[model samples]
Target: MTETTVTPTHASRTGGRHDEIRFGTSGSTGEARHWFRLPHQMEREVELIGTRLVGPVDRVLNYAPPQHLFGALFGQWLPRIAGVPVHQAWADPFAPLPVSPGERVLAVCIPMAWDLLRRSLPVLERAGSVVALHSSAAAPPTAHELVRRAAPLLRAHEILGSTETGGLAHRPLLPEGPEGGDAGPWQALPDVSFVRDAGAPTRGPEELVIRGPRLARPEHGTRPPDRWATGDLVEFTGPRAFRLVGRSSSLIKVNGVKVHLARVDEQLKACLPQTECVVLPLPDDSLAGEGYVVFWSGRGHAVGIADVRAALRDFPSPSQIVELAGIPRTPTGKPDRSALFAEFAPTSA
Candidate 1:
């Protein structure tokens, strides 16, 4: 009898094996966890997202950080699954991407990146090959205007979704209007379904919940529900369309009146032109609860506490307003509300 030797093939150097999927998650309670996704699981995610994101002749350029879920799936895995040649820009998107003009280029960038591009509109206009600009993290309306003016062919889309659920929906940033607008309904890709709260009313402002094939399994020691309550509050504008109101966690009570932060944010932006503002709740001892505080970021803006209070007259009265050189933004460009409150809110001794 002859003994035969078998060689073991090592895992793919690109991280885990094609069969083993790795996911990084920060749960609703704000705990970080990682899980291994079976080959089939990852394949489903690719199938669900690829059809929506890629085109027959598209070439992707990703500047999103790979560590985050949106960035990992769309920026890294999706291209591999779709078999498209992606140009991973060495330079940050907040800065100019390393590539020059080329045909059929699909650009995925954050709002800050778009803002930078807007600042250099003349240079962007020269990159004629740019076709689509899909933005997430945060919506940059001003930058959207710049893109429209500089590159007519470039379409800007604001995608909606989070770590727990992948890119569940998208809205258009250009040709802004109600009917047949570029922003499509907040549609589930294929196998995904929105879980509604039975206790709540049938529609409008229901807790945004999710259940789908790609829905991640909860980690050990966590009382994970099969369906994820997204913590987002959404209103159904149409049968399939929804407008994100704000996070349920972000809801604050002022003088026994409930106020949504996003609503206040809208009022502030409407009142203070060209200036960006975020309303945060500060812990109050006298109130035996929390009070409102606002932080605004912009240049050449004369927004004052009085002006802000006047603007918000029709809305909830905020406790105070502080001027900031720039808002402390998350890596993805959304305001870091907690950080601001922690640093700025006066401590009661």
Candidate 2:
């Protein structure tokens, strides 16, 4: 997606009088789709996030472009609600934030910005307080550690939702234990609830059917549905809390065995916390059907193909483990799977 210049008029405005606010879905899976939300729907979302997720803030250092849902809500709406100034220069993930000493900052960031923020620890420590908001992907373990070791006032939060659902659930990015990062479940936001998908099997991971006030309407301007069936499969850990199992679309069959691409990627990420990698399914005649491939970048680290293979010993070995200088990503910082497949699938085959 193209980045739009942030202006004072654009940054301070809210969707108060618009007939419907249109947002483009992050084109991580394919072509971007358009969704619409009523002005009241957006106001309620901002209210919930502002009251529950965000408190008073001196200013906002927004690292996400306003086009993305998370960016629009937190980067734009939240600061406007709080009547705080915003710094959009930090929108570039790699750029150093302009946080000043004694200013309580609401650092709106996407998942990809965490690593770059980690590199700016000294600069971050100068702030009176920092609340880092992350979305568009899972927050890396490093982000949790960054919060754990930073000034006691530093906090990191992760939001789980889509452009269509706005902000459905959130959880703090706590420090990882010796075993691994905190695998805690996400708590549904106020006025939001979910259940197992009706068509799902009685056992195993089930797709979620979410019901909430934040649901966006179709771009055609119809009334929003009472419930939204999401593609994400999850396991209920408690009332109003659940851990993501994976996405139904991401679950692929390989040699008659079920493999979740998200789960595989998570395990690989666990092993190489600093290295960037993704697992994708590919056609394989020898395997009798689809097989998986690992696309990884050392990112200046000494990680190797051997290291990646060693980490996947328990799972089905990837047909190919290719390393690149860097992983391609969408404007929202999600891995551009279509681009990756187009560039590498032919060579892998």
Candidate 3:
């Protein structure tokens, strides 16, 4: 392995019809581990996304990194299949879109990048029918509204899934709704099926077991079940759709009370509508072993811990409040959670 590269576990053999490439997890804990994917698996995933989301696209405007699932499909695979040109929007954030009016363009971007481009949506108004797909991380409904309002003809889709699952589901968010308004249950993509695990605890939310061709081959030494039981908790709204409760892993105990980190994020965003927040768990020494830390950003808006605590009386209080220009994120647009956690986590003595 190179100095900058740490090799992930996988087994591959070349030459002949037996050609296959496998990818390992980025190091998961305990018995549960991520699966390996073959090239065909990747191809099948891209096909599903292109058919359901990027239908007959003439060009791809990719602003996300090629390493990410959303970006790789748009930047490379989709463009290859569509015989269309791809403009590297990440190369120049403010540069004019390489698109014209009435053209079909699949614009792939992330939540953070969208926040910046949303301001310049007026310029993209002339840029033809853009099917803007936001993924990698959750995008606030306001971000969708901004783009929808600015580009009146823009088609918006929020793909809900991870690098491990490809794209499990996608919801059409066209014409955007109010900031705090719920968009309802997410409709699962074709070729995917969901099952509620029977072994999940009754006291807390339940886990959803997903099984599909787009999924990875069980690699870990664990029970290697046919279906992957994702940590994402959900409440069934319909047969094919479900409202995401939160990740089971995101649950923490505070003062003997169960607190959902996702709920904390939602409440903080609701209280401070203008500001963006990322709620993190820190080591609590007192009654609760886990203390909550809130990181928020509103540009020019000044938000204080006391004020936020006042706004949220029904929720548990945060042990700390950190305000910054914006939430720090990884190159792939995922929240730099480890960095955020490290900011307050005590260093070794």
Candidate 4:
């Protein structure tokens, strides 16, 4: 999906108890989709997340932008509920200290923020106890490696969901844990329920259908009786825990064999986390169809084309492996796939 833009700026700027803030969606389909969230919706979110956070946290340090859902939760609703001083310093790692010794701080962070914090963990860790929260995208192994190195200095709580789904599940990580650097199984939020749809011949993986009061309604003006199907395909590990297998919309076919982009992403992340890797379809001149390309970014000791190919040997290797100073990101810190493809995609005559 493309970067989300706030709609009808008036309500977003002047929020009311029941006022709705609209967010526009632009994805593969050129058509636009709208999602509405009211102040009460955010309040419900703060109440749910606070069950695990509030009492333990003395202050809220939000680094996410206040416009988006996750950011609104931490930057606005959460602090309001806790009645604590709120701080926003997503760009700077040291935006004054959120807490002193013996006090706990609930810090909202994305993977990018953690990347910066990893370099100065010693000082940050000494400041106080932190319940570091992350969302928007999966935390890279490199970021987890940093947390593992800092052990006990801070605890990472990775929340999994999108703008449409307020908060689905979250997994806890420490400097040291059994799961380590891999993406561990996630437990669904207390109020969220999940069901898997039956697999069809055209589908690459089974999709997870969810039902919760917290999820946003569709802009198309249609509302299901109980649930909404998420784009993600997941495998249940236990009663409430599940692991993401792939995304139904992210499949690429090569000579009739299906390859999931999510699998490629996982393989690349397992092998190389210093740089972010995203697979985009390339033009296949011979077959008059589509091929795949691996575009990545980062510097210093970055992964080379040869290494990426070797790691993805078990899977389909892209036709090209390109690197940049950084991966293009959306306002919410997700890989801007549409933008990346446009910038790096090979043109055909």
Candidate 5:
């Protein structure tokens, strides 16, 4: 899907709510799709996420894609709910910042867009500028430091939740300590609870099951959520705190070793500059099982298959690494692993 445009109206200029907003999702395992949210729903969401997190803010500089969850909730709706000016753009990160510094401003961002914006931090920070940067979709561990250095006053936030449950929790990205830093105590949204596995002693490496108002009913004939099983694997730090590992389906078993694809890709991408890579499971016809494969996007890089092998010395040997024009990406800029793997499926003998 491509970017969308919003028009100016009396409601927009006078700080009234945006009557309609588009919500899009690249399904858990396939291409992207979009839906339209009416004014009442948009207002409810704006106040819901805004008052909960930032609290009665006056202005927001929206940069997150309107189609994404966090973007639609925080970036687009938050300002309207707060009755403040909203500066938004439907363009690439290369575009200039819509609002000036030294003003109380907030922006919702994803990992990729955060990385792109951090590239221009020298121009982003100001005396009274308070940047509430919320990152979701994927953690921007790679861009945390750049964000801190560029905007000293920036308070980077990582939003934890799905479209179904709204924003479940938030953690800040601090300057010192862990690279993918976290801030604030994890607090559950009102009326939301963790649905634990029946057999587990507590929430430990269990799926993120949720029960809440935002949990949508099954649509398009989709399967109903048996208590909204998130399929995301998480590890608990406390009764209320948990760190996300990855999606349950994203975990691959190789020779009895469970490998997190995100971890493997992070290690490989660290070694290869400018190359964005994605790892996926491909079923082996001969082996009667599945193995890993990586697809990367970039040019003008000398890194080859052998370099990748050496970089992945500690990692398991994937079935293959097939370089392509680009790693197939969903409309939301996330990798389309299932589609990519099918492209390389072995032919029947």
Candidate 6:
């Protein structure tokens, strides 16, 4: 894991002297990009989130590191705004939560933390009320069961955003059935709005152009753009709500057929509930111009390469199937795609 260093610099703006906070991207896509934000801008985010997502709370248990944007917002700022004491003892993935019997606890977590917390159900059940905040990735099926078992006592919410865009949208994590959870369409934040990219096709999923107050300035210290064109594709469901179609970069043409790696990953996850899988695109010399490989880990389960092939038979199968002891992940808990490519991608013979 590489360390991200944040250097706060002072800048003289129109109204007052404001300090800029630097944040490093997760580097899941490729090289990390640095972005800057003003303290007041970040405060506005804290205010919006504190008013919308966070309600009255007795204490906050922060599982995310404060260096990450999500962590800083919920873990550092939200607690201060709520005037509540926060405990970081639960930072360790395997540590037990500090929830008391009657406290209304706000648990700020990343996607990976949910699985660890689910294992300590006996402790979580003791809380009077639990508002679990999830971000950085989609919550797994285990999170749904965690909420179900703690029913009437726990409620979970997922936030959608990135390092460049502070916080764009949010949705309640609701149980669909006995099987898994549904993070329905994301609703834009009060300060955020979206438009379809001009270059996008008229008929289908379009790229989202985000207009918001929380947009970060480029690392070179220029004014933030009025509207930031994002690489994510979405289908608008309402005036301010949309269902994510997938990332533009994740949609690739394989053998002249379009394939969405995120969608394929979702399918594989549903089929192999006990296994962790990642599907990554690879270059091909064939007319297709692109190919993909599936990497999976059984997590002590009996799943095998043959099982993965059978699951993906109906879809465009991968050119290779590689099993590993575990999938590589960024410090922020996203699949380390760049690292995976460097390690597993074939070299020129």
Best by TM-score: 6
Q: How high a TM-score does candidate 2 get?
A: 0.86
* TM-score against truth, every candidate: 0.79, 0.86, 0.83, 0.83, 0.75, 0.89
- Tens digits of lDDT, candidate 3, 1-349: 0001111223533221233334333332123233445667667877888887778888788887664556665677788877989988777777876666667777787765676567666656666677878776677655666666766567787888755566788887655443447766789998889876567543446677788877644444322246777788887777788877787776888767788888877776667777777877675676546767877776577766566667557766667777677787766555676667666644321
Write candidate 5's Cα lDDT for 1-349 as tens digits.
1222223221222233445343444555434443333455446655655666555454676666665666666666676566678766435557766555566667666556666666656555642555565644454444566655755566666566655445666666555423233333455666567877677856456777877655532323232244667677777777666776667876887777878876687677567646667777665446646578777655657766787777678877887777777666554455665668766645321
Which sections of candidate 4 miss by over 4 Å? 1-18, 26-32, 53-55, 91-94, 119-123, 126-128, 174-182, 198-204, 220-225, 281-286, 345-349
lDDT assessment of candidate 5: 0.59
Residue 158 Cα positional deviation in candidate 4, in Å, after optimal superposition: 0.9
Q: List the residue pairs that clash in candidate 3.
A: none
lDDT of 1 by residue, 137-230 (tens): 4556665565567556466555666555555666556544222232345655566677765677766676788776665434342322467677
Clashing pairs in 4: none
TM-score of 4: 0.83
Per-residue lDDT, model 3, residue 321, is 71
Better structure of 3 and 6 per lDDT: 6
What order do candidates take by lDDT, descending? 6, 2, 4, 3, 5, 1
lDDT score for residue 192 of model 6: 91
Backbone collisions counted per model: 2, 0, 0, 0, 1, 0
| Selected candidate, larger lDDT, 2 vs 6 | 6
Local error of candidate 2 at 120, Å? 3.8
User: Residue 157: error of model 5 in Å?
Assistant: 0.9
Task: Give the clash total for candidate 2.
Answer: 0
Worst 10 residues of 4 by lDDT: 8-17
Candidate 2 residues lying further than 4 Å off, grouped into runs, are: 1-18, 90-100, 177-179, 197-203, 283-287, 346-349
